[model samples]
Target: MKALKIAKSPDDAIKELLSSLFENQKIKGVFSLFYDQDYFYGLVTDKELFNKLTPTAPVMPANGGKMLSRLTMIEPPAVPIAVVLKPCELRAFYELSKLEQANLENLIFISFVCAGVLSLKEIKNNIEEKVANANQKQGLRECCQLCENFVPENADLILPLIDGDNKTTIFIKTERGEELLQGIENNLVEEDFDSAKLSSIKEERSRYREKTWQNLKTENLGIPGLIDIFGRCINCHACGRACPICYCNLCYFDSADNDSGPRVYEAELERRGALRAPSGTIFYHIGRMIHVSLSCVGCGMCSDVCPVSIPVGTIFTRVAEETQRLFNYVPGRNLEEKIPISTFEIKEFEELGEA
Candidate 1:
């Protein structure tokens, strides 16, 4: 991989690079996290606003994939724009693109070896401390703590966080990335990505994932356990709202057809003798599981936004692991990879019929 070593802090180095890109008219705008009183994903068009860009912030209030979908769903940009996304968020964007929920035309993707993100629950407390401990996995979101896909795929440019010399290492992975850095004065250095470090981290997270998922499985075993875990749901749908993969304009649960009249509630109440006030709560969870399990990137946005702290992201991710394995598929792994459900195979599932 081609490398560009910038002798500045990661945030500062990235800011400078993006500023140069914008000033040189290489990219019309940059999509990254911006710092106001809080960090949020936004587009920075004016060079003056470039300093406010916080591309490596440890907190993720929402997945960037949903924002990109909104930006390019109607039509792709006329000019090339650079989008800086975390590994998981970029994966989610790729999944959305495959679903035709996003257009990838005229876009430049810059990703990073993610150190995971702190939960939104911890966003209000000790921002500096959280960022400092981001790589160590303390106080990070559960899905992030166990995430194995921290390495980005299909990224044009990647920022390496493994080096500790206080230099930002930019690895060029594509011809587009090479062209983007062509005009800039760069030091050509032979650099090797620390694959051993990456493997160690992956192994540690794999062990953690097995242990965590085992506990979750034991806790939520049968239908009653599922009901117990999800019983506190107020049907607020905050999880669905925050989920990057749940991109439907109108969710089935929120549709007018789902609204039960008084008589229907009365009939159900009479039949069961009691009913959960917000009915179909379990059904909604199951429905979402069926819909998004294949494409869930385990970004943890769903669980992060859950008001009742239902661990929605964890549950969905666990289910997704099974579904994706069954289909021998990996979501967001490639732009050209077809979604399993969208395709038809005549001989598929023949074993079920034989039985």
Candidate 2:
């Protein structure tokens, strides 16, 4: 309902806002991306480092939700800290909060109207060009191109990534956001949130998602397809490490219980002509899907971290879509929307013969 008029660039406007917050002592720290040799996330406390804050960076090295969980899983900060994240990261945070892996106390979430992001590899080459081409089909991460939930549902603040707009418009979505803007010299201009543009983007992404999903399904539906896709897996478990939703402290797949001894491998090799070394590759993927598909926010971190170029994020997003649809649930749509697994219904899944 309110927009912050930018005197210079959008980044500068955000920096100015952050500077004010720090100088005013409104926040004790900030959790956001900073530019160094590369863009990285840090809990910034020094006022001098505010210039390095690229809260709108087009590269996501890691999911903000996971990083935030590492900071606050055990205990929340004593003072308020501002957290700047992409819409999907914010949604992922909400999911983690529900799973009791993140504490939501004394934190301000700032999200944005994402224009998608470039792949980590492509970003190192011709960064500006890739950012300019973010709205296009090329150079973006697959999940971003097909992401429908770009508009964050319930963030404290929202920065709209509108092209060719000189003034950086910051929308205050909650009282916390309004309070953060106080004592700052900015006019509160009335403007409608651009629902029309958002709807158009959503439609475009949905079309792309369906088209890509169709192609992916054709290649990855049956057992043979699954093997073809997952056969290259080196059993690195990097996907799970990068995933914000895969927050189990001691993953069963990584624990001693899942380990295969030499005798077991020898017996399996004797029964069959050969065995897939470091076996259960496909089982690991399926197990992860069953565990986190309902809460997955499709942030694309898993695919980004995959050394084998497996489209892990895309597969999980596809699975999450179907599972969430069946349960009539949307993760991180709001704080109050109950996760389907945490609740039970007598009539639920009755059509599937559950009674």
My TM-score estimates for the predictions, one after another, are 0.95, 0.93
At residue 6, candidate 1 shows an lDDT of: 87
lDDT tens digits, residues 1-355, model 1? 7888888888888888888888888999999888876779998788898889888888797899889889999899999899999999999999999988999999999999887888888867866666666657578889888899999878998887777757788888899989988877467566676578789889988999999987888344678988888999999999989898899989989999999999998998899889887789999999999999999999999889988889888888899999999998899998777888998688888778676
Shift in Å, residue 162, candidate 2: 0.9
Model 2, global lDDT? 0.86
Candidate 2 lDDT by residue in tens digits, 1-355: 8767666566777788777887788888889988876778999998888889888877898998889988999999999899998999999899999988999999998888887778887787776566656656678899999999899878988877673556687788888888877877467877778888778888999999999998898444787888888889999999999999999879999999999898889899899979986699999999999999999999999898899999999999998999999888999987788888898888665568645
Give per-residue lDDT, candidate 2, residue 195: 81
Top candidate on lDDT is 1
Model 2: residues >4 Å from true position, as ranges?
124-135, 163-165, 218-220, 351-355
